[model samples]
Target: MEIYSSLGIQAGISIFSHIFFIGITFYALQAFRLDQLFKKGRTIQIQLIYILLSIAIGSSVSNFILDISNWSKQLPYIFT
Candidate 1:
């Protein structure tokens, strides 16, 4: 139960952080009106691709950052 609780907290934090970044990216894209510049049919396609690529890249990046931060947390124990 304790382990599950701990894991849940970590997972929740990771998910929220990822969502925050994804939301911000979409917000910025909207602000720049990037989708409006494309042809009508292609606009939807481009937006889909953009969103998928962003999630793929963003997840990898956020995982890397989380790993690094957790690595620091474990550093002291390794030396001991």
Candidate 2:
């Protein structure tokens, strides 16, 4: 079915894009050695913050892509 095929394509693209975004974000953070800037116990907190921020950024980017593709009418609803 055309509908099912299109859905599958979109899903695949979304997953791949998210992985790429998160991977690049982590790579950049690691390259900066952000952990070294924090104390031992604080490293965990910083890592958590970095990861969440990366996800938030990735989600926003993906939402923007979806909007540009005209896949959905509404803007991203969260964190507004």
Candidate 3:
């Protein structure tokens, strides 16, 4: 029960952090005038690629770490 509660709290924190990171990324992009450097069509394409890559990288990294942590937590019981 205690472990479950800890996991829930960690998950919530992870979600909040990801959201905050994405917000900061967009804010920084706009502040830097990155959009102005590209032609209209290229800008849209670049933005789309940037967003897709961010989601893919973030999801994989987060899931991999979470899975490793979960495995480590189970290892003690399995070994015993």
Candidate 4:
């Protein structure tokens, strides 16, 4: 009962974190000149790259934050 509720909460937090970070990542990525790096007329490919990069970077950041949060919560176990 309680465990299931906790799991649901955790899942919700994970989803929110991923989405929030992905949006932030996408916004930050706007500063990059990635379009210049690719060949001209690859608009679709460039768009895909942007989406993939956003997910990659965002998910990585989200995981790192979650790991830190979990670790902090476990710190009490380090002692009696």
Instruction: Show pairs that collide, candidate 2.
Output: none
lDDT pick, better of 1 and 4: 4
How good is model 2 by TM-score? 0.65
Model 3 agreement with the true structure over 30-65: per-residue lDDT tens digits: 545556667886977778766765566565666666
Could you list the CA RMSD of all candidates, in the order they appear?
2.6, 7.2, 4.7, 0.6
Clashing pairs in 1: none
Better structure of 2 and 4 per TM-score: 4
Q: What is the clash count of model 2?
A: 0
Q: What is candidate 1's lDDT per residue for 1-80, written digit by digit as tens? A: 99999999999999987887777666655556556668777966887867886687677667778899899999999878
lDDT for 79 (candidate 4): 100
| 36 Cα displacement, candidate 4 (Å) | 0.4
Residues 4-80, candidate 4, lDDT per residue (tens digit)? 99999999999999999999999999999999999999999999999999999999999999999999999999996
Worst 10 residues of 2 by lDDT: 70-79
Give TM per candidate.
0.72, 0.65, 0.58, 0.97
User: Which residue runs of candidate 3 sit more than 4 Å off their true CA positions?
Assistant: 1-4, 16-40
* Local lDDT at 17 for model 3: 57
Model 2 whole-model lDDT (C-alpha atoms)? 0.76
List the candidate 2 regions with Cα displacement exceeding 4 Å. Answer: 30-40, 71-80
lDDT of each: 0.78, 0.76, 0.68, 0.98
Question: Between prediction 2 and prediction 3, which has the larger lDDT?
Answer: 2
The prediction achieving the highest lDDT against the true structure is: 4
